[model samples]
Target chain A: MVEIRMRVNGVSESLDVPPWVSLLDVLREHLGLTGTKRGCDQGACGACTVLVDGERINACLALAVQYTGRDITTIEGVAGGGDPHPLQTAFIRDDGFQCGYCTSGQICSAIGMLAEHGAGSASAVTEHVAATGIALSGAEIRERMSGNLCRCGAYNGIVRAIQDVAESPR
Target chain B: MRPFAYVSAPDVATAVRAIGTEPGAKFIGGGTNLVDLMREGVERPGTVIDITALPLTGVEELPGGGVRIGALVRNAHLAAHRLIRNRYPLLSQAILTGASAQLRNMATAGGNLLQRTRCPYFYDGAAACNKREPGSGCDAMDGFNRNHGVLGVSDSCIATHPSDMCVALAALDAIVEVESVRGVRRVPMAEFHRLPGDTPHLETTLAADELVTAVELPALPVAATSRYRKVRDRASYAFALVSVAAALEVDDGTVTAVRLALGGVAAKPWRAYEAERILLGAPATEESFRRAAAAELAPATGRPQNAFKIELARRTLVETLRQLLTEGSAA
Candidate 1:
């Protein structure tokens, strides 16, 4: 057994999980953080998306022991005081979730996407990297968030929700 | 997932020693591919050496005008590096067209090259995969080969290397620096990944104890005009049907220098040496391009659903070459 201490959802949590247990499994089964859904146990689906050290990654593809000493931010931690984050509110306003199964992952992924954009990270669609802050285009947003899939076919609204947040005042 | 021992190596020396101490030990870099395989029972390692914390992340300029990328450098950082974007444009484009944004952030350079194929039969424990089980028959050959290999594929295995960065590195003449309990050695990109012949289980030339430390790219002049193109089922987040990474330099309507490599069509990164030989010093024309592409793909023996890859690869190479030539002429 490996004891790992990580800051999950703004709280310090410690658990002695088997070395092979994935972070997604620990979050859902052991700690009861089921908001991070698991669509496919493999890395194909983004339902297990979470932020480790302020970067989005598929928790299902990560071992919990490998994430020690990292600041973890899951979907449940995005909202404090039972209130929604601005991105979460925007996603709801835009009706981004049709079946609502991939919402948490989608929201967590979009927040990380915005952070990447803010830091001037370029996507496949972005032609210029040295150029200053990129203008968020629909194609850019779609390409950047392509890892997160919503089986409900709600990509259009999700794109719009992310675009709305990207355009909002910082 | 099965039970395993986990240890975090504080530095390179400890990491090297840990691998030698543990049996069936696998180094964990990004955990993007290894962890998924572990969950599916594909990899049953008795020990997992977490190598991510070691101070092995950087993209530094080599003394000889080239670049040395650390093994732990994230895919996103490697793709977005200033020199890589400006000089090695194909490398940047290749990494960007790979997995999604989140996966790129987590995927490391060494892990990306070492990732196993996404063959369904290999992942599904019920099916017979020569790669997963040595002596077992290959189900992909007789079954769904829509994503199987077309070049350098032996009867024993037909899985393709599922990496975009490696394809670009192959074209750029990159070399991988690896360390093991014994010592350190440098492996050229062309010889790093092995073609699955009778021993389908053996993927790379690196020994089990060897750990990839860095990838060194040789300096080149054609890198200024490099490009990477991929044709996939979807516009994004999908593996390539056929991808091309090319760096060309044409002078006075004649091919002065050309470096081309292919992905999603071979057992390894298909470096188009034959095609380069045909195009170098030849005039830039549509007919020459066709002949060159045909020469490069002559060894392509595709399965039923994947025969279209032959034509797609041909067109992709022709298109990329034409674009490069046109951009050169305009400049």
Candidate 2:
């Protein structure tokens, strides 16, 4: 077992985990932070999406030992000051999910996507990649959030919820 | 996943030494591909050397107006780097088109180059795949092979290289820099990956002990106008059924310079040298573009399900060149 230290949801935690234990397994099994769901253990489904140092990645693909000393933010961490994140409220208002299995990942992925867009990152659908300040169009949101899949096919509402949060003045 | 001893390398020398000393050891970058394959039982490394801590994550400007991208640079970071987006937009575009945003965030440049094919046979333990176990028959040859390669295929295997980023790198004439205890060697991007030939298991030129240090994109002015077009089952988050990476420079309606590479068609990124030869000094017209694409694809062979890839590749290449032409004229 390897001793791993990481900051999860603003809490510094240390644990001894096997080398092959995935970050998703560590979060769900060890730390009991089960909000980060595991849809496809592979990287195909974004149900295990989490933020490591503010960048979104699939927890299912990351080894727990490889993320030592990094800041990890999961769906459970999105809420701030004892209140649901605005995107979470928007998800509820827009009915952004048919089943709740993918909700946590969608919310976490959206937060990272918003941060990336704010940093002027270009998506596959972006017309001019070199342009500054990417416009958060619906197409751009869909393209950016394509990593996360909704088996219930609630993409319309998910896109709507994300668009609401993106258009709203933070 | 099988249990393995893990060692986080503090530097390049330690990482190389760890892999060089242990025959069962493998280097882990982002663990996006290696971990997945490990879970699938396709990759069983007794020891995993984590090299993410190595100081090889910079995107530096070379002295010759080119760019040297560190091997550990994450795909998302490389795609978003200001120099990459402005100077090598095709590379940026290609990186964005592959996998998904989450995968890209964790996948590194070196890891992307070394990623294995997504062929179902290769992943399925029950299926026979020479790449998985040499001397084993290839199931993809007669199985559901709609996604298999059409060029540079051997009877032993028909798996297509599943990277969009490498296709652009090949077109830009990038050089892969690798190092080991033996010494450092530079391999041109076009020659980095190997053809299936008789040994489908041997994928790249790098030995097991070598670590990819960096990828150098040589100064190529044509890359500025280049574009990558990937035709997949969906518009977003799908591997290419056929893809084209091309840069064209026309001088007074005559093609002066051209670079063409194809994806989802071969064991390696198929650089269309025949098509490039035809396009150079030829009229930059639809007729010439189609002729060149045909000449390059004349030797291509495809199975029943994947036969469409030949025409798809030709059309995609012609269309990409035409789009570049239009963009060039507009500029």
Candidate 3:
């Protein structure tokens, strides 16, 4: 057994778990935060995506013990108390998901993707590597968000939702 | 996944010591591919030595104009690094084109080089895969051989090395620096990944006690003008069906020198040495490109499902060289 200490969704939590338990399990079973869904736990499907220190990664492939001192933000932490985050509202408005098995991961990944773009990161489609704060074209967003898959074929709506937040203040 | 002893090493020495002493111990960085293998019951280690805590995360300039990339450097950071993107554009393009943004953010350079093939037969536990279990026989030899390697195929296995980063490294004359309990030794990228001969299980030449500390790319002006073009079923987040990494130098309307490598067609990054020989000092023309590409792909033995790869590889190489020549003309 390994006792790991980390801030999960803005809450300080210390939990003892098996060394084999993934970060996805720590979020879903250990902390009882079931918002992060697990689909294809081998990291093929991005259904278990979460933010560790503001960067998106597949939680299912990450060991909870390896993330002892980092801050993990799940779908629960996108907005703290009163209102949903801008991207969350944008997803609802644009109908980003159809069946919604991949909604949570999609939202969390979008949050990190926008943050990465704000930090002057380039995507696969970015022709100019040195250019900072790249123009968030649809093709660029699509390529960056390619990890999150929607079996219901909701890519058009998902792109619209991300674009809506890209132009917003939040 | 089987629970094992875990040690998070604080320094490089500690990590190397633990890794060298522990039999069946594996280094965990990013855990993108290794963890997947564990889940598939392909790899069961006695211990996992965590090397992420060690101070091996940076892209720094060498004494020469080349660059030294730390082993723990994430794929995203390496792609975004100014030195890599500016000096080795093909490397940057290759890294960005291989995996998704999230995976790239977590996957390390060392782990990226050691990633296994995406062959379905290898992943299937019930299937007969010589790479997984020696003498089991290859299911992909005649079963669902679409994604199998056409070049460098042995009777034992037909898997392709699924890495875009290494393909670019091969073309740019990069060297892999590895350290063990003994000492550090440098292996060229061309010789780092081994072809799937009789022993397909032995993917890389990395020793059990050794750890890849850094990948060094020598100074090459031609690599600055290099380009990588990948053809696949999807435009993003998929392994290459046929990828080309090309670095060219043209002088007085003639090709002075060239470095070319192909991926998704072989067990290792297939360096087009004969092709480059033909293009060097030749006029930059479609005829010359075709001749060179044909020389490189002549030895390819296609399967029933993947026979299209030969012509596709041919066209892709010609198209890339055409664009390179056009860009040079415009410049």
Q: Tell me, by DockQ, which candidate is best.
A: 2
Identify the runs in model 1 with alpha carbons over 4 angstroms from their true place.
A80-83, A129-131, B327-331
Weakest 10 consecutive residues, lDDT, candidate 1 chain A?
A: A125-134
Q: Which stretches of candidate 3 lie over 4 Å from their true place?
A: B328-331
lDDT of 2 by residue, B58-85 (tens): 9999998899999999999999999988
Model 2: CAPRI class: medium
Which is the better candidate, 1 or 3, if ranked by lDDT? Answer: 3
In candidate 1, the residue pairs with backbone N, CA or C atoms under 3 Å apart (3 or more residues apart, or in different chains) clash, namely none
CA lDDT, candidate 1, residue A68: 80
Among these predictions, the greatest lDDT belongs to: 2
Candidate 1 per-residue lDDT over residues B61-86, each given as its tens digit: 98878999999999998987888887
Worst 10 residues of 1 chain B by lDDT: B322-331
Estimate, for each residue in B1-331, the C-alpha lDDT of model 3 and write its tens digit. Answer: 8778888889878888998788999999999998888888888998999898988898999987999999999999998888887788888888989888779988999999999999998989999999999999999988998777888899999899999999999999899999987889999998899898899999989998889999999999898778888999988888999999998888997998798999999899989999999999999889999999999899999889988888888888998888777763111
Docking class for model 3 is medium
- When 1 and 3 are scored with TM-score, the better candidate is 3
TM-score of every prediction relative to native: 0.96, 0.99, 0.98
